[model samples]
Target: MKSLSVKLFCLLLVVLLTTPAVAEIVVEPEDITWTTDAGIVTFQIRFHNPDPTAWADEVSCTLYAQDFGVFLPNQNEIGTYDVPPIPPDSFFDVFMEIPFDQLPPPPEVHHPWDPMKVQPYCTPDDHWDGNVDLIWAGPGGAGTIDSHLGTLLVCPTYGASEIHVVTNCVINMTYTITGVCAGFTVQLVNEDYTAAPSPLAANWSGYIRVTADATVPIGTVCCFTVNFTCGGSTIPLILCAEACDCGPISNEDLDWGRVKSLYK
Candidate 1:
């Protein structure tokens, strides 16, 4: 009887000691903060790792933009990290660089001519810059609610529109015009607004077919003057400029401040 009681006590102790305890891993400053120089935005994410034994061999972090609902509106897979183990209750910083000329710019970037004096409704204005929100996902507590990060632009560079693009091959042009550029719709039409077969379209702010009659060259800006016909009458829209085959990815926005940036 004594031996049996001892064994039972030992088993209970092992169970109590070995059972995993869940400590919520908290990432601080829940939103990503950015700064711009040139045209790239280097996002600095600071986190507090509560787990001593928990470390990551590789972590995949992604950035996305959303509209209204939490569902992914538009997402750009930023990249991954090979973060080693983080000692328990430790703090660390991780970063990703987004070039102004490459990835579409954040809508909040201010433009000189914007009448509202509010930042461009959509930035980098290379793509639909309006109504898009940012999201961050990763491993090592990445997907968990606590692991995600929200982003807000602190200081952003503007005027990405003047950059040039050079493409060697023939291209397709797509167009869509919203109140401030929304949705992806493509239609090809002649100068007189007639659809032309085998028309090339550009995929931007939603794909649309360009006016076929305009003989736009490779480096020339193919400006689209469009009208959005939606829950009402025709809404006029303008795409100032677009270029193809610009250059490699660059993060013009990577300047850090005295404070830390975090994911909320």
Candidate 2:
């Protein structure tokens, strides 16, 4: 019995010594950025794996937002990607674009509707989250690591605007600001006027004209502002005249001949 026990212990020690160690896998967000334009939101995210001996593959990401239903159509919320194998201690980037126009309009307000009261037109600004999962097939066996991309502010989309002018006339202009929080003031400032709606709130859209003397030299740049303020948070936006209408000698229309002259 003593000889048999010693042989069993030796066998167990040999098996343990020959087993390979599993590589530790880790996933983290390296960078995240977003831009909203023309009722569309585009997001770019970079993910990193810090494990020096593990390569990641079969990567996928899912985005989540509480207000996604309000701004995106049914089944338009999920996105997937097949990432190329990331060598140990490396990173990869992915991009996603969401269209807000496909979403259904806000439900109608009920009960004692008051025209004197302002109403929110869209979902309020909120935090957006995502999950990233990938596989590490090395050493011991196939393993997976799930990571959270953290939260980011999903600001409302602000459409593009341009100042329209014919020779020397400032055309009345309109801009739409969506997805701001409730009770926020939308202020516009430019060479023209610093004006806000009488009662500004989220999902506000209106028009402002150049208050300055409209008669300026052709090709002058006219910039306008849209400021959204809720509590202590404020979002400021600027729109240039060239966006709407081109001016004589418009900065964008400069000839190649003129560009060459500057280099000389």
- What's the lDDT for all of these models? 0.35, 0.35
> Best by TM-score, which number?
1
Model 2 CA lDDT for position 92: 74
lDDT at residue 86 of model 1 (Cα atoms): 52
Candidate 2 TM-score over all chains jointly? 0.31
Q: Which stretches of candidate 2 lie over 4 Å from their true place?
A: 1-32, 68-76, 102-264
List model 2 lDDT by residue over 1-264, tens digit each: 999999999999999988643433344333545545666666665656666876655444554322211111133343555555566787777787766443222211111111112113212222232233334344323444332221111111212221211111122223344433332223333323235443443443333232222333323344434433444433333332321112123222332111111100
Candidate 1 — which residues are off by over 4 angstroms? Answer: 18-22, 28-31, 50-60, 65-72, 108-264
* lDDT (tens digit, per residue) of candidate 1 on 48-86: 566665443234444443221111235454444544445
CA RMSD of all predictions: 16.6, 17.1
